[model samples]
Target: MRRRLSIVLTLLTVMMLGVIVTGLSFGEPGAAPMDDYFIENSQSESGANNVVTAVLFDYRGLDTLGEAAVLFTAALGTTLIFRRRRDD
Candidate 1:
């Protein structure tokens, strides 16, 4: 048990060190380039002042409805999974 614990601890230390080294290597994404295209397109198409409201209420409403349907389906599936099936 002691030997297993030491081996696991050593492996965990090595993994954490690897992650820390990786963090120093890659920089975070630039903001301007990412937002520019989407901002330009969504604003032109939607015709609304507030971007989030336009996206949610008008432009992407279908997508939101699909997402709601998916959530409803998941809930129904979960309920059905826990339900006792009648064999009559």
Candidate 2:
């Protein structure tokens, strides 16, 4: 039973490593249509000079806010967890 588990785990590890190597060989991904759209229209639609700023604040405002909220919550939780409590 132990030998079987070891063999299975080893095979799984090798398969995962093979997948990673194969993925890396493809190099960087090509841009999608959305990238072109954002580059072209971000300034006119969002009125931001910077494309990145327009995308983050205008195009994906809610998503950015949600991410910020999640990060803030995580930080607060970590702070609370590690806070020193002085027992009276």
Model 2, 1-88: lDDT tens digits are: 9999989999999999999988884435545778889989999999999999999999999999999999999999999998999999
What are the C-alpha RMSDs, in order, of all predicted structures?
8.9, 7.8
**TM-score of every model versus the real structure:** 0.42, 0.66
Candidate 1's residue-wise lDDT over 1-88, tens digit each?
9999989999999999999988885446555674565566766777777777777867779999999999999999999998998999
Cα miss at 15, model 2 (Å)? 18
Candidate 2: misplaced stretches above 4 Å? 1-30
Q: Work out candidate 1's RMSD over C-alphas.
A: 8.9
TM-score of candidate 2 on Cα atoms, chains taken together: 0.66
Clashing pairs in 2: none
